[model samples]
Target: MTNAAHIRLLTTLEHSLDSGQQVVSLTNDEDPLTLKDRVDRIERIELHFPHFTDGRAYSQAYLLRRRLGFKGDLRATGDVLIDQLIQMKRTGFSSAVLKDGVDPADAQRQFERFPAFYQSDVASETPVLRPGALEKPE
Candidate 1:
């Protein structure tokens, strides 16, 4: 919205639809597609996780991707951690803002730890078999 001459800010879901705003900021508990008829207007989604333990953001991301079919930027904000990066990507987060003082290289290694996975995620909505695949959980 920076490049646009006018930026429309809507506080609530109803206000957004009522005002015809394209951008939205959602709390973890709030569904991104509140106004189903105007879902296409959503250009970006920012999921706020108050704490690592508060993983409602993850569910919100999944709903946006699989249910709402949101193709816009799904960003993770607040209390993010290196360990949650892969899961974030799997669920549909396009990018994340990390905490200060965290090493980017070391954090990247966390994603490398798992060469493949069995669960169907946003990256691969259907599970696929890859070489050296981990045994399916019993």
Candidate 2:
């Protein structure tokens, strides 16, 4: 799970993005592979959720991280919820803008509840929660 500073909760999108930043807003249907050539030039990519039930952005984020190897910020926008933050981080979202009415502190608590996991994710190739898993046996 990401720290409070890592996963930002924005009450609104207005003025959230910095001017002159190399940002790309990709719809759920867009293919992240299309940006492979320009990944290095990009600084941030915003993936939209559209509706709370729509999860295509997750795949998009994964592709951006695992396939395209984008190291820049991966932000989640629109219809984001506190419950989705855990999976969002696992899939490679560096930040999220919480939807209206969601408490930022509550979102922080969610990360606190599950600080690590046993599954391999985009950020790490091996299970992180297991003791000594990161070290090779002699």
Candidate 3:
């Protein structure tokens, strides 16, 4: 589904609770609660990017998945570009809402280029160093 079709924009905490539907909102600079606390009750949490230059949402997506252990869908909204689709997916965003003028088909094409999982070490417990880092072979 398209990001615009699935995402809830400018959604407030109270409104989200009342609607009982998944919501995604922009992070205010002064919020004291942790990301986990903010999204704990919601079925899905989305991070917003007001502009391409503002990248705080990327960090939020990473924290929501890697640190807070959020399993539900994480989406990216606003100023989303075709170039950013792959990186956004890699950072843990399951989907995104592109800007008003952009084409969804382009975004879909970008999303298809990368594999589902990007990190090689995610499946392994130990860190793997370079081949010649330890010693030379005979």
Candidate 4:
């Protein structure tokens, strides 16, 4: 029921999962909601930004988190940069594979540059200084 051309093009989540690979890739054109029904089988989802300006992956990451409730690793692979790491984290990317020439040390510095966030995102449950903002409460 399968053809070599199709098999060469797409391996599918089911096949990857069965092969013991926990991670999967999603292009910008691929709708994140399409995975909502298959989230359980996905352990990690890699969202490709393609270009730093191409922000469709952020929405994909958001939907994967808030909608599909994907809690596993959300990795930013394509066009990854220090300038976008924070936002990527906010959008639920746990890890990122930066493009060449970007130093990992600089990435860590960027993460530390902002002590708190102003808006609620997947990485932060609440805005900074707001009630119940990363605090146990008095």
Q: How many clashes (backbone N, Cα, C below 3 Å) per candidate? A: 0, 0, 0, 0
Best by TM-score: 2
Stretches of model 4 off by over 4 angstroms after superposition? 1-20, 131-138
Task: Kindly list the per-residue Cα lDDT of model 2 for residues 32-134, writing each as its tens digit.
Answer: 9999999999988999999989999999999999888899888899999888988998899988888767777888888789867788887567786577757
Clashing pairs in 2: none
Q: What is residue 6's positional error in candidate 1, in angstroms? A: 32
Whole-structure CA lDDT of model 4: 0.70
Q: Which residues of candidate 1, in runs, are more than 4 Å off?
A: 1-22, 130-138
**lDDT of candidate 1 vs native?**
0.68
lDDT of 3 by residue, 1-138 (tens): 344322222223322343337665646342213656656666666577777888787777777777777767676766777787666665667656656666556656664565344233212223355456589778
TM-score leaderboard ranking: 2, 4, 1, 3
By summed lDDT, which 10 consecutive residues of candidate 3 come out lowest? 5-14
Q: Global lDDT of each model?
A: 0.68, 0.83, 0.58, 0.70
- Using TM-score as the yardstick, the better of models 1 and 2 is 2
What's the TM-score of every candidate structure? Answer: 0.72, 0.84, 0.63, 0.77
**For model 4, how does the per-residue alpha-carbon lDDT over 25-137 read when each residue is reduced to its tens digit?**
89999998877777988877888878888999989989998988897767677777678877877787776665666656666766667768677878779786676657776
Look at candidate 3 and give me any clashing residue pairs.
none
lDDT by residue (tens digit), candidate 1, 1-138? 111111121223323344323657788778666846665668777788889999999988888888878877676777878788788888888766666655556656666687567777787766666555677767
